[model samples]
Target: MEGRQLQQVLNTQRLKSLQEWMQESSITLTQVNGQRKYGGPPPGWQGPVPGPGCEVFISQIPRDVYEDRLIPLFQSIGTIYEFRLMMNFSGQNRGFAYAKYGDPLTASTAVMTLHHYRLPEGGCLTVRKSTEKRQLRLGDLPTSINQLELLTVLRMLSDGVEEVLLKMAGPKGREVVALVNYSSHYAASMAKKVLAQAFKKHYGISITVKWTSFSKSKHVSETGQEDGTFTPPGLSPLPKPSITPPHLHPKPSLQDVPAHPPLQSFFRAVGSPAGLPRDEMKPQGPVNRDAVSLLQWMCEVNRLGTPRYEVRFHHASSDGFLCFSYEVLIPCFLIPLYGVIQILPGPSVQATKEEVYRAVAELVIQTICKVSNARPF
Candidate 1:
């Protein structure tokens, strides 16, 4: 019995040494792989084949699902390194889970086979690759805010927002919340700081930033669906037009106002105005005193149009351009031709202002050209 115990001890020590060696070698090999990829494994996995590191994400899961029900189903594709189903405060399945696999090939195989596989529950599952990059979600916001207001506040946070998943907390028990997913954690952190400061000043609400993940439970209240942002309100549902309707909402009439360049003319070959009269294309007066009201219509158009343009500012006089810091052109009818693009507006500014104007014109023209091809705006 003593000799047997001694042999067992020796075997344990040998296994420990092998594990330590493998760990060290794996680190070294990872370093040598040029950071982007690995050159196989130095010693490689001890199994019959090599494995690649990959993570899989699953969504649309039924509420009754549990980890036990998933393990067997996932094991058929490849060995699972880790499995996690996001949970809510009630510890219920959030209807989404992430599984890390030993190899990308195996992960791919699993995704292909099980993307629409029906579970014992009523819903089917959707599977895809997991992103190491986190999507930021801001929660605990006051429910009164709208998406435009939310986006304005968040833009103060960071310029790195590739996309944002924004939400307003539901009424009743629902909290006003916003989720801002940035391209990087560093970006997310900076956004939290900037938005916190801006929100306090603008909305008088204290904003909390969180690395947002989906709530585990799929069940949501009707108000939650409306307010929580799982399904954002339709474009028309935004705040109604505040502008008093134009005494006569300008119709596309040639008799009253200049004929609009035909949509076809604008989209035709470069520099081609089709056959629209040039004199008619000139400014039709300073967009009327109802200019302020016209802005609301522009905003509405932006909301409904693809490649939307948010109205940032309006410039009436050239002095307002400098005093109000409206450095850019008015960007509406008549202003581009009569205001900014007009020759010798002022010699007081920089001599290179002409060059700057040319560059800006090029950029604006390119943008218009590209946007014109889109559905609208």
Candidate 2:
């Protein structure tokens, strides 16, 4: 047993060691691939080298489309090494993305096949090999404009805003420089035109908007530039509408009771007076006449004084007594039955004619049993 246990422990240790070795090798392989990709392919790496051909730019993506949706769509053509859907800080899709496939051939095939492909949800895709070495950036935005306002203004004019970076240009951080990353080149251009016009008209200042090449070394400024030269244009304020007074109606007197008297009488009849016995109030026979009459009246009122239920007394052979069966129009009888049961104690009675019949039968049985038990032997 000791030898067997030792052997099992050794096996477990070996398995763990193998797993660790595999993980380390994977990390090393990934590092090698990264070096080759960013730097250059290693010595003796054969055949037409994989360049930007392995990466494809997809545009006109719907706002709802995310990385998960894009993966399945492109997986048919190639294995995705990297899938990224650019999103703003608010987590909204920027409507464009870059997907890098495992091989250049696969990437090229995907580009050709998916280009101008109409999505079921809406929008035709514009797929192509990404040639633009730098991401498009918009500059010369008002420093006074915050990220939210900038996004709103850009969205009003363009399709979507991917990112926004603020910086201070002049000495002592006096000038604010806002850099915005738009999804597509066309969207960026459109925003530039629209915003330039808007600023010129609203603020009476010419806002310079231009695209900048992507740079890894370029870091977004942490602090905003406080420049008094130009103030950001605010949204046009609207005048608040005046509130209207609600119409009031006079309370009806007791003499006007005929209109709504049935409902009031239905509730009053179901409830017992202070001196009344609770047990005697059970629906056994003519003892609960008030309750029965009120319930019937309520049903009549509901059906416009028409009888909506058929009440029949069945003779029970075993008990030698009559059992009541109520066949009622479900909708018409339920409203009053609900009010009748509310005044009674114990479990809540169901709003059904059959339920009412069952309750009445059970009450009769209990009353009979109580009287029989009360008699002397």
Candidate 3:
């Protein structure tokens, strides 16, 4: 009876242990699956948590690096939302730029991969997440400046002009606040200085230039209220020449020739009595169709399919020593059989017709075998 009691006690303990283990296992599984529910990292993750902001600041840019050359480098890593080179008022690159990626992950990737990367033109890039926002504005312009004049000034200021916004503050649209968007901040900075100088020289007023936040300019563009105010004209027309030049002589025309004889006869009538040499006037002979037919027959007999090819035979001397060259399309898979069959004389003489045919047949068979064995990559 005691032994039966002990066995029962042992059975209960075993059951209790099993239940506890199952409960613990269930809790472990729940904890693991609930990780994402609380916005935790996924399983097997091994990297820094992605940061905010898609804009990256790039410093130490080469002076010659323009938008066309700069965008491609970062674009290879991810989609580029914005590329801007920082420039000075003199239309010179300030050796820095900003690139905004479509996502923070992409921006992070570009920073990690390209930071301290050496540029082709001679500078190592200093790439990092941008903390400060950039704004590009050209303020305090002559109110009378039209869109055409603004464009002209901007063009002379720098290249890579993406968008131009002109806000007329005063009456008669005389005081213009020009918002210029360049591919790079470098370009914008350069335009500011040059434009100020140009405005002072052209209009005799000290133009005020300001670099505002990008958000302000972007908002003005997206609203579309000022877009149609002034349609910027095409490139400024070239300046006219100072002096008029003499008229050029008209070229002689074939239609003006006399109707009695054709142009060829007219030329002959005016030339020496003796005509061109016989060799010079003679036309080339027709291709030897017989040789082509023979080669085609051989190819067909050898089970070589109808491949696009050209064959030409030349008979140099009266000795009937014929030399021929041919080109045929061979599938890439059969390239291994390229030199399998080459026609050659037994000792030193030229290859005979039969020998050439035999060689071609052997080449075709080898090519077929190679193609049959080839496997797609």
Alpha-carbon shift of residue 39 in model 2 (angstroms): 19
Candidate 1: tens digits of C-alpha lDDT, residues 77-126: 87765565554433345567656666788888999999999987468988
In terms of lDDT, the best-performing candidate is 3
Off by over 4 Å in 2: 1-50, 132-377
TM-score of each prediction: 0.28, 0.26, 0.27
Q: Per-residue lDDT of 1-377 in model 2, one digit per residue for the tens?
A: 97676555343443454346546534121121001111122222222223345777777877555544465688678656555555543333556766766578998899889999998768998888764221233445544445434443343334434445566655555565665654333234345446565545433445666434322222111111111111123212111111111101122222332243232232233344467564443223221233333333332223322223344444344544334454433342234212111112213212233344435433433343474463111
Sort by lDDT, best first: what order?
Answer: 3, 2, 1
After superposition, the stretches of candidate 3 with alpha carbons farther than 4 Å from their true spots are: 1-55, 58-106, 112-135, 170-175, 214-377
Q: 1 or 2, which is superior by TM-score?
A: 1
How well does candidate 1 score on lDDT at residue 367?
46
TM-score of 1: 0.28
Candidate 3, residues 1-377, lDDT tens digits: the string is 97676555343443454346546534121111101011112233223222237778777766555444566688798766556555443333456666766678898899999999997667898888764322245666544444433543343344434345567654554556766655433334444446565545433556676655432242212121111112223222222111111111221222322223332232232232266643342212211123323333333333443333333343334554445454444323353233323343333222243344344434444455565673111
C-alpha RMSD of each candidate structure in angstroms: 22.2, 33.0, 32.1
